[model samples]
Structure formats: structure tokens, C-alpha cells
Target: MNRKHFLSSFIAAATVLPTFKTLANTVESESSSFKIPPYLKQGDTIGITSPAGYITLEQIQPAVLQMQSWGFAIKIGDTIGKRDFTYGGTDEERLTDFQKMLDDPNIKAIMCARGGYGFVRIIDRLDFSTFQKNPKWIIGFSDITVLHCHLAKNYGIASIHSKMCNSFPDDWSKAELVQIETILSIKNALIGERMGYTAPAHPNNRQGKADGILVGGNLSIIETLAGSDSDLTTKNKILFIEDTGEYLYSVDRMLWNLKRSGKLKNLKGLIIGGFKVKPDDAGEEFGKTIYDIVSEKVKEYNYPVAFDFPVGHQRNNFALKCGANHTLTVSETGSVLQSF
Candidate 1:
């Protein structure tokens, strides 16, 4: 072959090779490391426990009856009525109850009774070896984000970040009942389509579409887990965060923790959920709003960013499957979240 022909061919191959490599890496990033735990069926037993604060059986009786009405049996944990100050039980007792539920083969899922501030205390002491071998859904939000992150980061098992036993209503509304049933039922829970949110457009919202595993929960819990064994790896993954009642300065501080620690450096997308922040005091001023704090920190990323996602401590809180691969589409019109 002529020298000119050889040089031109070599340049073409060099340019083509990087494009192929980039495509391959993209495919690999989107591949699943997540396990979808077996969903519940009729007559399946759901073990309910208070892994955080104290709650009387009277408070949860409505939910228990509701579950039975839906053809599921409720297994109440010992911690349900026990009180040791603010928590249902001591750390040891709570951990034991949780471990028992985790190892119980008949318990198809474990639903948290409520969320307070005790999960981070016992999270490290609990064993998941047995649960890993026979995986089932672990459900809750708020403080339960600890368990969700632990399971996702260490075991790669998907969990429900939704309303807990305390949130279940006795007089169920049609829409609320449907949401609860959809996440608990076996077939549909694993493969059903997610109801998307139509968020009000914000100037800070970034426009684009992305696909990756969804990993995040309460912003405070996530911040606490940072740099730990169970901390999340946000690279090439979509993150959704929410928190409530925190001071504005603390919220800004947590956002900086995520940014400076390199957790927000790479991502497929970001979803900002309901932040029911506390109002500033009479004389104090935090200066920036929640949107201002977040947008400034994430200004460098070009990935899709959706604000006011309908998940968090609110009446409209929607269920999300942590560790599941999802397609996140954000536009000026709104956003859609779907599992693949």
C-alpha cells in the first residue's frame, strides 16, 4: 500500500478506537449491580418492627389491620411497645429484633414501624449474611436511609424507601391505598411502571436525560454515612436527596460535605426532593435559600437536575426502589422516574 493511504488508515483507526471505548464504558456503567429482592404475595408475612423510636401497638394497629385486610399477615416485633426513653428499645434489643426478622425465612419483608434517630446506632452491629443469601425487601425512609445505603453499598440489594407502618392510614384513601399495594405486591412491585412527577420549573433546573442506578435518601443520613464503609459511590449514578426541619446553615454545610468530599463530582442525574426546612430565627439570617445552596454546589455538572421531586416527609411522599437501575428524564416541562 502507498504511504499516504497507510497514514490516513491509521488516523481513522485511532479516532474510531476511543469512540468504541467510550461506548463500552457507558454500557458497563449502566449495567446492574443491584438485586431486586423477592416481593410479597398474598398470605406472606411482613415483620413490623420499631428500629428507631418508640411506638405503641395502638398507634400501629390500624396498619396491622390494613395489612391483614390485604391478605398479608403481620409479624409484630418485641420492640413495638417497649420504651427506653426516646427509642423503642436499647441498641442491643433493637438490633436483635431486626436480626431475627432478617433471618426469618417466612418473613417476606420487614417494614419499619417508624423513623426517628436510632438506626445509625445499631446499623453497624447488625448481620446481613443470612439475609443476603435469602434476600427480601427492607422498607422505610428517613433514618432507614442508613439500612438502604448499607444494603445498596454492601449487599447490592434493592429496598423500598417509602411510608412506614406509622404512616399507614386507617381510613385509606383510594390513591394512597393503591400506592401501598403497588410496592408490596410481588409481580407488579418488581416490574410495574412508576408514576412520574410534574415539577414546577425552576431557573436552577438543568435540562437533559440520564440512566443509572438511583441511590440516595434523607440528606442528613447520607451526610453521616459519607467516608464510612457503607458510604455511597455517586459516580455515574443518579442521586436523590431529601431532609426536613434542619436549619438552613446546616443544609448548606451538608451540601458542601457532599461536594468537597467528591461525592457530587460525577453523576447521571440529581433529584432534589421535598425539603421541609425550618424557618430562620428572629435575628439570624442564612442568606441563601435551599435552591441557592444546591445549585451553586452542582453548577459544574451538566447532567439532568430536577427539583421538588415528590418524595420525602410529606403527604405526597412516593415510593422509590433504592439500588434499582432507573431512567431519569428532566426537562423544562417536568421530570419522569422509571425503573428498567
Candidate 2:
């Protein structure tokens, strides 16, 4: 090639290379810049609101009393007990209730009353300016995963992924209730000694060690938010996912989407939480279990993958700090997930 042709090619490559490098660096910085919210203490007022499905005041009374018993003042939002079809309230009503709690200085933490299918409707309409100034824990799982991913991707604030008011047992002796309280008080998680669980290993499990900020919640929500502004960044991040009531084929499809989108291509680790899938109809099987679908999708990556880690849609659901760094170890014996 002539000097003139070579010169043109060199100049074009130089101009585009820096732009790609800069973009990669920006994404890395944004993913690692999360700010931990202040931990709750006695006398701290907790605000309960429904960002998704409807909940009756009577249904949440047990949770209210539980918070009170823990010495935290409870302020129930107006959205509760108000119904607009399947949602707790109209979009405007839910947005107003959540906005008030976000802006209120006295409410140290915002607890979701339930998670159904409405947070996405009003998530874009709500503002988080005041929330950034006085960051506090936003708690719940499932539909609340929308908030968890949005906060991590945009605002860089950590939130709680745990049982909400709807999941509080009628009798507090259940182990889940204790796990919920331990996370809220932040005594255990703050010291990096968050409660850990063990489960029998699946044949498809990948054994290894990985440490990165643990970020993920319901698999359905994560898949629903994919390619949107709230999509998660799994690069060098420990991605944990759980779901409930999904068909086997549907689970396979969602995991395929994550793999194709490059979300599962690079990860420090992968945790397969409780899928709680529905059984196929008689003789019309989807031909794969939840574990099979997940393992197949992530087969290319060697990161630690642990199955059935006691999370999602079950009485044993435990609290996970959505944006906090954590260490994961997978082996023949079992797997361990602990906050760092």
C-alpha cells in the first residue's frame, strides 16, 4: 500500500480507538461507584409503601407490629388499602406516595409493602434527587428488583433484597423473619458477617472462588428490564438470580437472552438462587429443569455457580445487600455466600 493510503488508515484507527477505550472505562467506574446507605437504628422511622401490587391494611398489620416491636417507628403510606385494579393505587397515587417517602427526611428507610407488577409503570416517573442527598435503604425483592437494578445502574446506591410486609409470617418465630430483621438493623451485614446458607450441590454446578459486588434479584425482573435503562451490568460482578412460577421453557428463554445480550459473558461469579418453577402439564414437558436451563446458558463461563441457595419466593428467603461486595465459594461439599 502507498504511504497516503496507510496514513489515512492510521489516522482513522487512532480517532476511533480512544472513544472505545473511554467508553469502557466509564462503564467500569460507574459500576464500582455505589454508595452504601446509612444503617438503621432504634427509633428510626420506617416508611412502608406499595410500589407494585395492591395490599390491604389488614394484611400488613403483622409487619407493622413487627417493626414497632423492633423499636422502629412505622409510617404506612397512603397507597396501602387503596386499589386500582391489580395495583395498590393509580400510577399517580403510587408515585406520589413513593416520592413523599423518598423526600422525607424523617424516614430513614423505605420498605416495600409488596411486589407484583407495577413498579415499572411508575419507576420512570418518580424522581430521586432528594433520595441522593439523604440515602436510605429501599427494601423488598421480586418486583422491587426494578428499583434495585435502577439504583445500582443509575444512582449507585445499595438497597435490600429481602422479604417485605406481605411475606411476614403470621407467627414471627419463622426463621425468615429473623433474617429480615438482622438485615434491617444492619448490625450483621455491616461487619461483613451476613448470614450464610448451605445447599446440596447440583451435578451441573461449577466449582471455584469469586469475589465481587453481589448484584441481582428476581430473574424475571432482570430479564424484563434487559436492554432498558435499568438493565444490570454483570462485568466483574457476582450476579445472583432467582425467580418463581415460570415455565421451564420461559426460564430457558430468559437465560438465553441474558447470554446473548453479553450480560452473562463476563462475570466474577454466578449464584443460582431458588427458581421455584411450575411443573409442566401432563405429558407436555418442556424437557429441561430450571437448573438445566441455567447451567446450559452459563456453560461457557468457568466462574463459580452454586444452585439452590435458599432465596426467592419461599419462607426461607434471606436478605441480600443488593449492591454490596461479597465473596462466593463453590465446591463439591457445598457453596457459601458471605458479604464482604
Candidate 3:
């Protein structure tokens, strides 16, 4: 009840409140910070492992030779030439191989050999404690989306969403220009070259410009991860998605899931990449084009939307730096995405 005592207590409370607020802000900043792994240099090593599908060592030779010509060493994992039904090997074998690559400081990057139907089986079992301390580039797409999303959600680490060993041509001399360019993009990303990509204009595009962190991968895999630890957080981010061999209805359903889960809202921009739709069953038709499905889901949002971006299961799939900041511009002429 004394004035001096009351004033002292008020000052003490005010001092403690500001300290608590500062600590809370620091924790939030650390949790959301994005990390880019060290770029590769000449003589650096890249470890190749099959975390998803099976592929023979012979199948990966073309990629090995090509990457070697770029002046980097290659480390083939034990899962190469491994088979366990549709998987690269027993789940344990694949996990151990990938874990070793993560722990090895000499291995500067990891390239998943192919994408089929694994990764999720071993994602929880594999420890990322060492990986968090020593981050490295993880490269692949399709099924490898699981790893990309997991890294983005849990660690704020960047990864490459690109073609794998299976996509490499046996003879580069005879390969198409697009194929060569797309493959070269991977090397460019690893060495930390600034990336810029443009897609031809489409009537479906909504013209605008925005800048934000880029995050997304195969649509189906993203849908599969909803509510899990690996689920993507797309707020204030440019989201680019692609998928293959899904029915039109399925693609629509996945987009709906994204919309319902708040992934489609609060986006800086949206890039719709290649979607190879399976034909409808003879008697049953799901009457909606890919554009229609996407437009309906994103109609209310004001962010830019670009279609036919050069990424996905096709040969034109260029490497993307997930969890990195990028600017996307959609104009009547075309759409350009530039990575910083």
C-alpha cells in the first residue's frame, strides 16, 4: 500500500515482460529460418542411393559418368542393384545407405537413384540428428518429394526437386536439347549458380508478380503428407506442384485437399507444372481438365498462377531449390521464376 513499494514492483514487472517478449521472438526466428547447404566444388563427392525404387548399378552408370565429367567424385551406395520386390532393397538397407551418406562429411550431396514407392517406409526410422548439424543437398523428384517436404517442414533446409539417375540418357550425344539442358540444371544448382526459368505463356495463367520462399513437389505426395510431420507449410510461399499418371478426378481431389488444408490460401504465387493424367475408364469419365480443377480451387485467391512450368515426370523437369527464396512473375508474354 506504500507508493515506493508499488513503484518498485511496477518497474520489476515491466523489465521482465520485455525480456520474455524478446526471448519469444528469438525462438520464432530460429524455428522458421531456412538453411542452404554448402555448394559443391571440384573434387567434391556426391553419394548416389536408391531410397525409393530399384535400379541396377548399370542403370546409374550414365549418370555417374556424366557427373564425373563435371569434376566431382561419385560414391555409389549399397542399395544400387538391390531389389526387394518393387523397392530398392529391404527398408533397412536403404535407410542405412542413406544414413551413412548423411553422416559422411566428404559426401557433399545425395542423389536418390530413382522414384517409385518407398521413402515413407523409412522416413521415420532414419535419424536426422547428424544431418541437421551437417546439411547436404538432396536431389530427386516424384517419390523423393517425401524427403523434400520432410526437410522443409522439420529443418527448414533446401533440397533439389529434379530428375534422378533413371532419367539420364545412356548416350548424351544423341539426347535432345531439352533433356541436356534439364540435366545440366542439376549441376548448376549443386554448384550454387543462380537459377532462372521461363515457361511459354498459357491462356490459363493469371498475370502478376510476387516474391517468397519456394516450396512444393509432386502433388500426390503432398496430399499424402497432410497432417503428418512432413506436411508442407505454404503460407506466404510460392508453391509449384506436378504429378503424373493420376486420373483427372484424383488430381481434383488432391487440389481440394490442399484448399481445405489452407495450403492454397495465403500463397505468394502458384505454379502448375506438368500433370500426366491417365485416361478415364471406358464408361466413367471425370469431366475436368487440369486447368479447370486448379482454377476452381484457387479462384478466390489474388496471387499469380502459372501453368505448364517445366517440371515433373517429363524430360523437361528442371531442378528446383525447395525452401529457398525466389521471385515469380507471370505476364502475358510468359512466366519467369528466378532463384536468389
Candidate 4:
């Protein structure tokens, strides 16, 4: 991506930019996508590790027990026992723990306890050969988006973008169980799935279908990888994005950056998860809800765009696939997501 493109897009605050022809380069979307790792069944062992931040041992047990109760055998990564401020320890220590779990054949899944911010420092150093050869579900959200993109893109493997390890897991709300089951099934995704939700559709929703590998995570981290190898190419695909701790204007800016970089041009569909909600009083800053900001800016396109699919910063975060093949459907009643 051209950093200059983002600057131009941010200033105009709209879709005013050069054409893809100007760039004259095309990155082909990989169609033969990989299968999402199967869901954890009874007797499967799930490994718990703190790769991005420090988690107190006392608090860690509860999270481990939570998984154990879910019928998964649990193992704690070595560095889950270490601590350095808000992190599990040195970058090397975190990397070792993560790699150990990733390399272990006994562990059916690797779940991070939390995501604060530490993976970037060690992303390039960690070895994923074992994982690529014998892939399993890698789950977490928030700052952990870093790992999702890295694992999905580099290895052409599937990973879960869902709740991370916490003393208090996301207890299901009264009406969210159906969506919750849909998300959990992603670990063991079956093809030709359908998932939809009630939403005020944009007039630009061409009322058609588009298929591509599902990609995207926290808006902040997605922007950070804009020009790097890990920076995902959104051509011919569905992009799901959500974030927290950002102003409404910042949300607009990142979407602009995505547009200018050609990330938004050829997208098949756009799924907007909950944006970072901050503590605020009664007043509208942008005079537009986050949904409005996204709809207005993205409406100019002719692809299907769905909002509020129960993913991201919200409490009942659904596990989403970052690089798996999926079909996106949108209509007045709701939206349907069919994973391959």
C-alpha cells in the first residue's frame, strides 16, 4: 500500500483517490483456501498460554477451569507461569511458550489468555512450520488480531478470532446463544453455512452474493500492517473489522485508509463488528453513529455490507475466521455466513 494514498484519502474524508489501474498491479486472491480447524470435542486437550500480556497465575486457573468444564483437557504453556509487568515476560519467553503450544501435537487448540500488545515484537521470530504442517485452531481477539493475520496469511491456515483467556469469560446473554453456537462451530466449520442478522441495509447492497476468504481483525492492527507482508489483500473477499478505544473520527480515517489503499475497492462484502466503545456522555460527535459512518463511506460501493453480527469489542464476541473460504449473504431480515 502507498502511505501517500492513505494521507490523501484521510484528508478528503471521502472516496477521492487514484484508480487501481494507476497502481497497475494485481494480487490474486487465493481460491483454494484451507479448512478451519475442527472444534474441540470431548477429550481434546486445549492449551492455555499468555502470549501477548501478563496474566496472574491466580486468575489464570479460572480460565483454565472454564475450558476444562467445556470438556477440554487443559495444559498451561511454560511462560504462562512467568510475568513482567503486563506481559508474560521477555519477548523470547512469550515466543517460546507460544511456539511450544503451537508445536505440540497433544494440544488440539492454542488459546491465548489475553491480548494487550506484545506479539508484534516477536511475530517474525516465531517458527510456525509445525503448525502449518499440523494446523489447529488458534483463538483470541483484540490485540491478538496480530496472530490471526500472521497465522492465516503466512501459513494459509485457519484461526479463530474470538474471546481470549480471562478470569471472567464472556457469559452468554439471554438472546445470544444461537449466535454463540454458530461462532463456536467455526472451530469445526462445516461448509455451506448460513448466518444473517437484522440490520438497516445500505441502498448500495447490490442484493447479490460474493465469495472470498474471510479476513480482518482489530482496525488498529489491520492498519499497522498496511504495507507489510502480513498486510492482507482484500480483493475478491469479505472483510470483517472491529475495534475499541478509537474515536468515531479515527474509525472513519482507517476506513478511508483502507479505501485509498485498494483494500476496499474489490471487496465482495464488508462486515462491521462493534467499534471500540469508549466512556461518553450524551452527545453525538460525528452526528452519525459508527454504523452511519461506515455505511455512508462504504455505501458508494455495490457489494453487500452487513453490520453488527455479534463480533469484536462486544461482550459476546463470536469466533471469526481470518483466511478461510466463506460466503456472505445479506437481506432485510438479517445476514447469513456460509463457511466452506
Global lDDT of each candidate: 0.77, 0.77, 0.86, 0.67
In candidate 2, where is summed lDDT lowest over 10 consecutive residues?
A: 7-16
Error of 3 at 149 (Å): 0.4
Tens digit per residue, CA lDDT, model 2, 1-340: 1111110001111000111111211233434646777676779899999989999999999889887887789999999999999999999999999999999999989989999999999988877877877778898999999999888777767788888898766766654643454334332332233445555667878999998888899998999988777888878889989999988888889899899999898899998887777898898899977777887888878899988776778755667887777788888977777665
Candidate 1: segments with Cα more than 4 A from true spot? 1-32, 173-198
Compute each candidate's TM-score over C-alphas: 0.85, 0.86, 0.91, 0.79
For model 1, residues 1-340, the per-residue Cα lDDT tens digits are 1111111001111000111111111222234467667656678899999999999999999778877876888899999998889998998889999999999999998989999989989988887878877888888899999988877667667788888877776666654643454334322342233423445667778899998888899999999988776687778889999999999999999999999998788888999988998999878988999899999999987899988876788765667778777788877766777765
TM-score of 1: 0.85
Candidate that would win on lDDT: 3
* Clashing residue pairs found in predicted model 1: none
Output the number of the TM-score-best candidate: 3
Alpha carbon lDDT at 326, candidate 1:
75
Candidate 2, pairs of clashing residues: none
Error of 3 at 49 (Å): 0.3
Model with the higher TM-score, candidate 1 or 3: 3
